[model samples]
Target: MVLSSPTWRERFRAGTVIPAHPLALTEQRKLDERHQRALTRYYLAAGAGGVAVGVHTTQFEIRDPRIGLYEPVLALAAEELRASDAIRVAGVCGNTAQAAREAQIARDLKYHAALLNLVALADSSIAEVVAHVRAIGEIMPIIGFYLQPAVGGQYFPVEFWRAFAEIESVIGIKIAPFNRYATQDVLRGVAESGRSHEIALYTGNDDHIVLDLLSGYHFSGCDLQIRGGLLGHWSVWTSCAVELHRQVRQAVESGKLVDPKWLLRNAEVTDMNAALFDVGHHFHGCIAGINEVLRRQGLLAGRWCLNPAEDLSGGQAQELDRVIATYPHLVDDQFVKQNLDTWLS
Candidate 1:
């Protein structure tokens, strides 16, 4: 089903933090249903607008037949989301047939939209990729993803984004190329698509979240803003991320000169992400790092990933400790502490 309700569309356009929900796995690398439900509760309690499940942060391996977690995970989140008006997004990946099947699953589960990952179409031409996207859009409302090359993402120039945005079912785009120039290309493409007003822009750039929210883009006579975030960085310390989004929205809506402090805080947040994402090791520990934070807060049982080899990098723990101590205000330990039991229940 598409986003047919004006209220739902308005809520999405109004902009709020939408965390890339993480998988809570047991020490045996199995899904911990209790902790998983608690995570959905935690994001809602922390004031997130919604959660994106089955995404990279949720572990792409969930789609593996041996594991068979894709449907169960999405169903769990959809069940929790039913009681609230919060937007529900499911991550859809793979080629035309595979992505369409995933989109159908998300649609069957009542997800409002599918965040389409095009990594599987990397070898296809731009036309073929757009065809694949259009095929998925036929099954569900689409949110385009420009994932970073450091992961499985492939580069698509301005023309490709313009065409992608032009698709009738496309409602949003997450610009997370993790490069300034690449991010700008998406802004330019969407602006030029003449459907800029129809599509909501979200920052997936973990390293540049604050500035992306605070800044605006002018291209081809159209002005645009990064309306919100669909971030893995937001999976942890989400209360703080929600507050930061609110502060940025207030500053931008005020239309006055932005305080220099916000700009300075941008650097601080980047430093924090460096540790959380393990930029030192090219983000090898990114998922584990996020899990580590939640584990420390008692939100997660442990930092176990489906892949046995995935764990925190050397000194990554030290870095996390330093950031936690240095940036006390950036975390929500107190918030998590107050309601951890309630969420777990």
Candidate 2:
């Protein structure tokens, strides 16, 4: 079941906020089913266009045979998305064989596409990597991921992206290399591929959300824009993220000079991400930081992760507190407060 329908393609291309769904764990490090469901409901209520489950924010350890959570988490989110026309993306990693199995699972659950993480093939050549991607594309539509190297991602040059864009099943690319030059390489490659119009561009660069959405790239005679975001930073204060995305989209579509205030807000949003993503500690506490905010908002019970050693880095909580206190306009605590009960129920 390929998600090649014009309606789905048009909606994805139009751009919308897609939160990288985080895992909700019990105090014992077990899956918190109720809170898990609530998180999906919260994303939908907060006006997210979609939720990306089994992704980095959900914790890669979920695929561990001992933990066995990959399917259940994807299923929970799928259940919630059934009533909506929201795009469903399941994060699939590993080599071709493992990724194929994962893609089959997501396909069975009705996911619209696979956000293919290539970290597992760090040592493989670009040609080998493309082969892996092609194998999985046979099972479902693909959304190529360019995860930042700071977190298990490998560097791929413009050639790799050009080949990736050429894949017939690829419908989008999430550019999150976190470096301006690398981001441009992706834009150039996709533009050079001549398939830019067919592949939607999404900013996974949490640190540069506003500017990415607001900026346009002209390469190989093709003008490219980041249509939306698929971010972990978005999972916490989602209602505000939705509004921010709307404003950015409007500015981009209008093709006029953006107000200076939007540029200022970009730095503010980056600062917020720095705190929540544990930038000071090399992102050692990134996942916990996201959970900490949700915990404070009552959306999560605690900041527990699958690995016991994974918890907030020292001063990370202080940073989160500082950002939350300083950026009341960027948080959705009040929004969550109003509908927490319904979501929890």
**RMSD in angstroms, all models?**
2.6, 2.6
What is the alpha-carbon lDDT of model 2 when measured against the actual structure?
0.94
lDDT of 2 by residue, 239-325 (tens): 999999998888777878889989999999999999999999999999999999999989899999999988999999999989989
Query: Which residue pairs collide in model 2, if any?
Result: none
lDDT of 1 by residue, 167-278 (tens): 9999999999999999999999999889999999999999999999999899999999998999999999999999999999999999999999998889889999999999
Quote the lDDT for 163 in model 1: 93
Once superposed on the true structure, which residue ranges of model 1 sit more than 4 Å away at CA?
A: 1-6
What is the overall TM-score of model 1 with all chains considered together? Answer: 0.98
Q: Which stretches of candidate 2 lie over 4 Å from their true place?
A: 1-6
How much is 45 displaced in model 1, in angstroms? 0.6
